[model samples]
Target: MSRAYGDDLRVLVLAAGASGMSARAAAARFNIGIAAAIRWLRRERETGERTARRQGKPRGSHLGVHETFIFDLIEGRWDWTYFEKVESSF
Candidate 1:
């Protein structure tokens, strides 16, 4: 999906600051959320960027730290239905 608000809306909100308009007022004027207007204006002040940030966790950071060990165990003991003997192993 695409971003709901574009750079043009963000620019309008930020520009409203110079005209003594509050973020809340700008948000209502643009039909956007108040928090969104504040966040956009703040981003422009701090980073000079008026676009939404990239979402989600970054690449190459997997949760499977022990994946290799688990695969090795399965490959080395291909004949084992050992979970039946040691239920806790599963």
Candidate 2:
């Protein structure tokens, strides 16, 4: 889902809604998901905005917060068995 649905498609879907087509119908007409049509319509109706927003992960890994801990665990116990390291990390 790196690619947000194109504005070209959004326009068609929004046009269908404006012309009294159901989201399901518009989705079928445009070969998209019912939820996508529904969301576009709802956003237009509520906020009067029809542009696609940024999609996908907002930032880096959650485990970033534990970087130091992970590094210390691995470096401090180089001789430990894999199972021992795994058990200690948890």
Candidate 3:
């Protein structure tokens, strides 16, 4: 996946705004998407932050809450075949 734009490019785009250039024009000039330019401009106007927002932790698995129960069941059946384990899981 593509990475977020850096502060340097954000500053350049915002500077274009200060110079009376439209967000779409700035985006075209910088080879970035118009929506990205608009969003970054909005972020800078609202919060005055040029840096990208921090990403939150990844979501936990749906089965995570049953981890202990699942592990215990497996530990007690170490000799079970893979298919047997799969069938028993249901």
Q: Give model 3's TM-score versus the native structure.
A: 0.57
Which whole-number lDDT from 0 to 100 does residue 50 have in model 3? 77
lDDT of 1 by residue, 1-90 (tens): 645677677778888965889889998898989888888877777888867777666666463896886677778776668664256356
Candidate number of the best TM-score: 2
On residues 10-90, what C-alpha lDDT tens digit does candidate 3 reach at each position?
889999987889999999999899999998888888998778876666767989998998788878987888788788878
What is the C-alpha lDDT profile of model 2 across 6-79, one tens digit per residue?
89999989998999999999999999988989999999999999999877769789989989987788788768
The stretch of ten residues in a row with the least summed lDDT in candidate 1 is 81-90
lDDT, model 1: 0.76
Off by over 4 Å in 2: 59-90
Q: What order do candidates take by TM-score, descending?
A: 2, 3, 1
